[model samples]
Each structure stands twice: as structure tokens, then as C-alpha cells.
Target chain A: MRELAKMVIVLTVLSSLSGGLLAMLREKTQDRIEQQVLEFVKGPAIRKILAGAANDPIADRFTLADGEAKRSFFVGKYDGKPDVVAFETFAGGYGGDVGLIVAVAVDTDQIVGVGVTTHNETPGVGAAVETDVGFIRQFTGLDIASGPKVTKDGGSINAISGATITSRAVCAAVGKAGDLYKRLKPEILKQLKTFSG
Target chain B: MAKTVTQEFVKGLWAEIPPFRLVLGLCPTLAVTKTVEDGIGMGVATGFVLVCSNLLISMLRNVIPSKVRIACYIIVVATFVTVVELLMQAFTYPLYLSLGIFIPLIVVNCIVLGRAEAFASKNKILPSIADGLGIGIGYTLSLAALGAVREVFGSGTFLGNPVFGPSFQPFTFMVQAPGAFVCLGLMLCLMNLAGKK
Candidate 1:
């Protein structure tokens, strides 16, 4: 009984110490991590899709409460006018989840451009989404209401060679983004006004 | 005593290297070696956790009851892993994203637990630190080497830059899942042949 008590006490103390240390570290690094996620992971894609914007889209971003989830939208301004918003959506792909950033011109309700933000898809195949800009560039000026699809599905966007599954996955993500844009259009517009000059 | 410490550190380099010799921690070995960048990043993170956990485990070895020792080691390992994860996400988000899921998975990394059970639980603080450093660095080097070979053959690029001209068609197969196994096997065979001499 004494031995068992000692073991239990030791385990409890060690666990408590571990938990306290981790909690403190998390608190210290929380903001810096969020900033890094904004600058590195999501920044390049937003900058690429919204290239002509006068302001830094990553810095001028906001989130909206959608049911239980908070959705972040990067605000892009062109000629000092806040007119574009880009956000991420995910789709199941060949290897894993493929992340796509869909940008829309708020005034035009048209996709400014679509960019690949994150993916674990097969390298040299599905990974072309990041390597091959032309594949993503096709989404520019696409009508969101039309619902973008691959050329095989009677849409204008061409599927990456030998990576049709990934291409379709990206299309699915874009389609989801379009739906989200429609659902959150009013909230997005209101958020954009706050960023506008 | 000094000789033993040196021995512990050096053994991890060639005699009992993870994935190569010990055949330990093969998951991260295969998963992160796609790029030299990711390989080094994971190796260093694993090393940090290993070193910190080993040091703490050694320090608390006597105080921790033998029956509950495993639980204490796990809590220690887990705490360090969380610290690494949060720090990486804060300072290096791109690397963090690429190494996603794997960071948290380090808690279960056999290397960390293996070292704690095999060496740290019985050793002094200085020796534990040495052991961790050796094993961690060895793991890092192996990943970096595998990453270099795979990236060169698979993509004809060295760290995302075109090492070969535009006409150089990449092997493409070298970066896939089977490619990782095949590459590691071939490298192991070479290591074995060299060891024989």
C-alpha cells in the first residue's frame, strides 16, 4: 500500500508540473505564433492572389463568427479602395487535405484569383498546385456564381496533367469558397468597410 | 566516467542511429526527409525535446517510483514536445506548417522514450545531455542526408531552386512514399557495406 501510494503521488506531481510548464509557455508564445501564421503560412498566398493590392492583406485581416467557427478573411485594397477579400478552404485530396485560398473582388463579386496555400498531396503530381502558378491563375476573373469546375466537368479551368484528382479537389475547395462567400457576403462587406479609406 | 559519456554520445551517431541502425523513429525519418529543409527542422526539434526530456528524466529518476516511472517520463517528454511545438509555430511558421502533425507526434517518437528508458532513467545529468545531443544530432544528419538525395533525384532542385536546367526532367518517383523506403534501404545497405570494412 505504501509503495502504491508513493507511485501515485509521484505521478500526480510530475503531471501537474508538466501541465503548468506547458500552459505558461503557451501563454507566452500565443501572439507571436498567430503573427507568424499570418506572415508566413498564409501571407504569401494572399499576396500572390491579390498582387495589385496597395495594402498588405495579411496585416489588414479580420475574422467573422460563422456559427461556432471563426472565419478569417484577408482584406485586399486596390488603388486605396478595399475591394478584395481572400480566405482559405480545404478539400480532401489524393495524399491529404489540399488548402486553397479563394480571392474575390467584393465590388465585382468575381474571383480575383485563387492560390494554393497548403497541401500534403503527392509531390511532383498534386504538388504542382504550388509549383505551377498557371494552374491557379486560371481562376482569376472566374464568376463565383457559375461555380468553378475542371474542364472535364464543362468548366474553363484545366486540370493539372496526370493530377486530375488534385485538380478536382482544388475545384471542390473553390466551390466551397464560393458558397461561403455568398453566405458571408454581407459580413464580408461590412468588414471591408472598416478597412476602407 | 568521461570516456563513458563520450561513448554514449558517439554511439548514437553510427552504431545505433535511428531508422538506419536501431530502426527506431522510422515514421519521421521517412515522412520529413522529402526536403533537406524539413529534415533538419524536424531533427532539431526532436533533438530539443530529447535533450530536455532526457535531462529532466535523469534529474528526477530517483524521486520517481519505479512503477510509475513510465508515466513520469511520458509527462516529461510530452511537456518538452509541447514547448518545441509552440516555439516552432511562433518563430518558424512555414517550417511549422510543413512539419505539421509530426511535431505533436514527437511525444510518441520512440527515440525520446527509448533514450529515457534506456539511458536517462539510469544516468546522471551530464551523461544524459551528452546522450541526447549525440542521438539527436545523428538523427538530424541522417534525415538531412536522405532529404538531400531524395530532393536532388525527385525534383532536380536543391532546396526549391532549380539545380538542373529547365530540360532536366525530375525522377518524380523519388519523392513518393515508396521512394522514401527505397532510398532509406539503399542507404542502409551502403552503410552496412561500409561498416563491414
Candidate 2:
């Protein structure tokens, strides 16, 4: 019993020390990390999707509460008005979750663009969701109420060659984003005023 | 005694080159080496975890109880792996996204645990550090070589840029899952041939 107690104590101390050190490191790197993620990972997709916006959408971003989760929205300005809001959605894909950044023009209620932020679909097959711009362009000007779907499912959006599952995943992600936009339209419109050009 | 430290470091580069020589940590070796960028990123991250864990494990070698030592090593290694994961997510977000689940998977990498059990737990701090650096760098180089070969043949590109010009058709077989195994197998054969020489 005494030897067991000693062993437990040693393990506990080691664990505690490790935890404390990790906590300190995390606290120090938290902000820099958040900045880096925004700049490198999601920056390109947001920029591409909101190409014509005058304001830097990534910088002019805010988070909104939707039930238990907080979702981030990037505001893009056109003609000095914050008229577009871009947000991310994750949907089930062939290999894993496919992340899509969907941007909507507040005044038009039409999709500005859609871009794949993250995906694990097979390269040269399902991964075409990220590489094929023509497919992605089909999302532009889509009305939020219509809810986009791939052509195989009786919708207008055409699935990529040999990548029907990934194409469906992209549609699913956009569909989720459209739902979120509809549910949070009032909140999103109210918050848009804060992001002035 | 004078050259022992140098020997330890040099052995990792050639005689004990991981995946190729030691044949440990093959998961990351295969999964992330699809691109040179990913291969180097994964290698460097693994090296950081290895070096830090080795140093800590060696420093606490005498203090940790034998029964709970493996558990203790895991905690220390996990702490470092988390740190790397956070840092990578922040600064190298693209690489982080590409590497995906493999980043968290580093925690279970046998190389990290193997070194702690075989070397760090028995050696002094300096030798352990040397061992870690050598092994980590060797792993990095091996991954890079594999990544280069795969990328060049599979995509006809080097580091995502067209290396073979437009006329060169890519041999797509080298980039898929089957390609990783075939490439690794052929690499092992080459290493064996070289070792005999």
C-alpha cells in the first residue's frame, strides 16, 4: 500500500507539472495562433469568395450566438456599405467533413460565392470540390430560399466528374449555410452596422 | 567517449534513419508525404515532440517510479504534442489543415514513445538531446525524400509547381495510398542494397 501510494503521488505530480506547463504555453500562444489561422488557413478562401468587397472581410468579422454555438461572420463592403457576410459550414463528405465558406449579399439575399475551406475527399476525384472553380461559381447568385443541391438530386448544381459524393458534401455545406443565414438574418443584419468601411 | 555524442547524432541520419532504417512512425511517413510541404511540416513537428519529450524524460529518469514511468512519459510527450498542434494551427494553418488528423495522431507515434523507453529513460540529458535531434532530423529527411519522389512522379510537380513542363504527363499512381506503400517498399529495398554496399 505504501509503495502504491508513492507511485500514485509521483504520477500525480508529474501530470500536474505537465498540465501547468502546457496551460502556460497555450495562454501565451493563443492570440498569435488565432491570428495565424485566420490569416493563413481561412484567409484565401474568404478573399476569393468575397473578391469584389472593398473592406477586408477577414478583419471585419464578428461572432454570433446561435443556440449553444457561436458562429463567426466576415463582413464585406461594397460601395461603402457592409452588404455581404461570409460564414463557414461543415458537412459530411466521402472521406470526412467538408468545410465550405458561403458568402451572402445582405441586400440581394443571393450568394456572392462559395469556397471550400477544408476537405478530405480523394485527390483528383472528390477533391475537385476545391480545385474546380466552374462548379463553385454555380453557387453565385443563388437565392438562400432555393437551397442549392447537386443535379443528380434534382437540383441545378452539376456534380464534379467522378466526385458526386464530394459535390454532394459541398451542396450540403451550402444548404446548412443558407439555413443559418435564414435563421440568423435579423441578428446578422443588425450586426452588419458595426462593420463600417 | 569524445566522439560518442557525434556518433549518436550521425547514426540517426544514416544507420538508424527512421521509417527507412528503424521502420518506426510509418503512419505519418506515409500519410503526410504526399507533398514536400506536408512531409517537412510533419517531420519538423515530430522532431520538436521527440526532442522535448526526450529531454524531459531523461531529466526525470531517476525521479519517475518504474511502474508508472510509461504513463508519466505519455503525459510529458502529450503536453509537447498539444503545444506543436496549437502552434501549427495558428502559424501554418494551410499545412495544419492539410495534415489534419495526422497532427493529433502524433501523440501515439511509436518513435516518440520508443525513444523514451529505449534511450531517454536510461541516458543523461545531453545524450538524450543528441539522440532526439539526430533521430528527428533523420525522420524529417526521409519524409522529405519520399515526398519529393511521390510529388515529382505523381503530379509532375515539385512542391506544387510544374517541374516537368506541360507536356510531361504525371504518373498518378505515386500519390495515392497504394503509392505510399509501394514507394516505401521500394525505398526500403534501395536502403537495404545501399547498406550491403
Candidate 3:
């Protein structure tokens, strides 16, 4: 009976101490961890798509209900007006769902730029889109509402010679982004006002 | 009680080095040794947990009941591992991504529990600390050595830099899982041969 009681008391004390220590650490690191994730995982692509923005798009961000799921959107200011927004969209690729960030001009309804943020496509073939500057460049200044597509699909954008599926996936992702933008434009504009100052 | 602090510490470095002499905690040793950076990061993380947990366990040795000591050790070790994980996510996000699930797995690492049960519970505070440091650093060094061997041969690069020349063809096999098994086996063989002398 003495041993059992001792065991219970010791275990309880140790567990509580451990919990307290971990809780303190978690609180201390929560904000910084969120910041680091933003800076590393999504920063490069946001910076590239919102190139030459007057403000840091990665820093100037907002999330809104796009249905049941809340999706984040990055804001880009050009000449001091936040008129372009970037958000991620996905479509099936050769290996998995390809994540593409499509930046659209709110005022002109044209694509500011597009960048491939994540993908699992074949290297040197489908995955080439990551650094295939010319391929992604084709989407710049294109009308977002037209639903971007490849030349083979009766669209002007030329697909990479060997990665038709990945090219189609990118185009489909951009189209999805177009639809998302149209759905969230009102909430996004309202959110952008908070950053306008 | 008879062993000095220095003796306890030094013994961990070579005589009972976690991976080679004791032949334990092979999970992270094989998985993260693909790069010197990863190896060092994992080593340092594990070392921090080992030292901290050992110190705590040693301090609480008398208070903890023998029946619940393992439970107490786990709580202590888990708290430190979580602290390391959160801190890593906050400051070293890239390394955190590379190490991934292995950081949490440190809870089950026999080295920590083994030391707590076998050495720390029976030792003084100073000796426990020394033992933890020695073993932690030993683990780090072993990981770094294995990582060097694999990275140089597999990727033809050291810590992301080209080691030989651009012309040197990478032995792709050394970077995969099977290569990890072979590399670890060879290292164990070498350690055994050296010990025989």
C-alpha cells in the first residue's frame, strides 16, 4: 500500500512538472514558429509572384472563408495601392496535387504573375516548372477570367514540350484561382483595407 | 558512487558511445545521416534532451518511486524533446522540416531511458550531467562522421557544396535508404574492429 501510494504521487508530480515546462515552451515559441513557417515555406514564391511590390506581400496577408475552409491570400501593393492579390490553388499533377500561386490584378483582372509553390512531378520533366522561367512567364499579363489553358487545349499558353499533364495542371490551378478570386473579391477587398494604412 | 565525474563523462565518448559501443538509437543515426548538417542538427537536438533529462532524472532520483521511474523518465525526456522541437520550428525551420517526425521519436530512444534507469538513477548530479554530455557529444560525432562518408560519396558534395569537381559523378545509391543500412553496418564493423585492438 505504501509503495502504491508513493508511485501514484511521484508519477503525478513528474507528469505535472513536465506538462508545465512544455506548456511554457509552447507558448514562448508559438508566434515565432508561425513566423518562420511563413518566411521559409511560402515567402519565396510570394516574393517572386508579387515582384517589385511597394509592400512586403508575405507580411501583408489575410485569410477569409472560401466556403467551409479558410484560405490565406497575400496582398501586393504597386505604386502604394494594394490592387493585386496572390493565393494558392491546386490541381492534379503527374505525381500529386500541384500547388500554384496565382497573382491577379484586382483592377485590371489580368494576371500579375504566377509561380509554382509546390509539386511532386517528375524532375527535369514535369518538375521543371519550378525553375522554367519562360513557361510560368507565359501566364503574366494574361486575363484571369479567360481560364488559362495550354495551346493544345485551344489556349495561347504553350505547354512544356514533354510535361503536358503538369502544364495542364498549372493552367487548371490558375483557373481555380480565378474562380476563388471572384468568390472572395468582396471579403478580400474589405480585408485589404486594414492594410491600406 | 565510486566513479569520478570525469570518468563517467569520458566513458560515454568512446567506451560506451551510444551507437557504436552500446549499439542503440540507430533510427535517427541512419535516417538523418544523409547530410552533415542534418546529422549535426539531430545530434545536438538529441544531446540537449539527453543532458537535460539526465540532469532532471538524477535530481529527482530519490523522490521517484522505483515502480514508476520509467514513467517519470519518459515524462522528463518527452518535455525536453518537445521543447527542442518547438525551438527548432521557431529558429531552425529548414532543419526542422528535414528531421521531421524523428524529433518526436526521441521519446522512445533507449539511450535516454537507459541512462536514466541504468546510470542517472544511481549517480550524483555532477556525474549524471557529465555522462549525458559525453554521450550526447559522442552521438553527435558518430552521426557527423557517418554523414560525411555518405554525403561525400553519395552526392559528391559536403554540406551542399561540391567537394570534388563538377565532373565527379555522384554515387546516387549512397543517398537512399538501402545505402543507410549498408553504411551503418560498415560503421558498426569498423567500430568492432577498432575495439578488438
Give the TM-score of each candidate: 0.81, 0.86, 0.88
What are the per-residue Cα lDDT tens digits for candidate 1 across A41-151? 778888987888898888899999878989999998888999889999999989888888889898888889888877888888888999787888787888876777889
- Among the candidates, what TM-score does chain A have in each? 0.95, 0.94, 0.85
At residue A165, what lDDT does model 2 achieve?
88
| Model 3: residues with Cα > 4 Å off, grouped in runs | A65-70, A90-97, A119-129, A132-135, A146-172, A193-197
**CAPRI-style quality class for the chain A–B interface of candidate 1:** medium
The positional error of residue A93 in candidate 2, measured at the CA in angstroms, is 5.3
Residue A94, candidate 3: alpha-carbon lDDT: 95
Candidate 1 residue runs with Cα over 4 Å from true position: A89-99, A118-187, B1-4, B14-21, B157-197
Query: Which candidate model has the greater DockQ, 1 or 3?
Result: 3
C-alpha local distance difference test of each model: 0.89, 0.90, 0.90
Residue range with the least summed lDDT across 10 consecutive positions in model 1 chain A: A139-148
| Cα displacement (Å) at residue B168, model 2 | 1.5
Higher-TM-score candidate of 2 and 3:
3
Candidate with best DockQ: 3
Kindly provide the TM-score of model 3 when superposed on the true structure, using C-alpha atoms.
Answer: 0.88
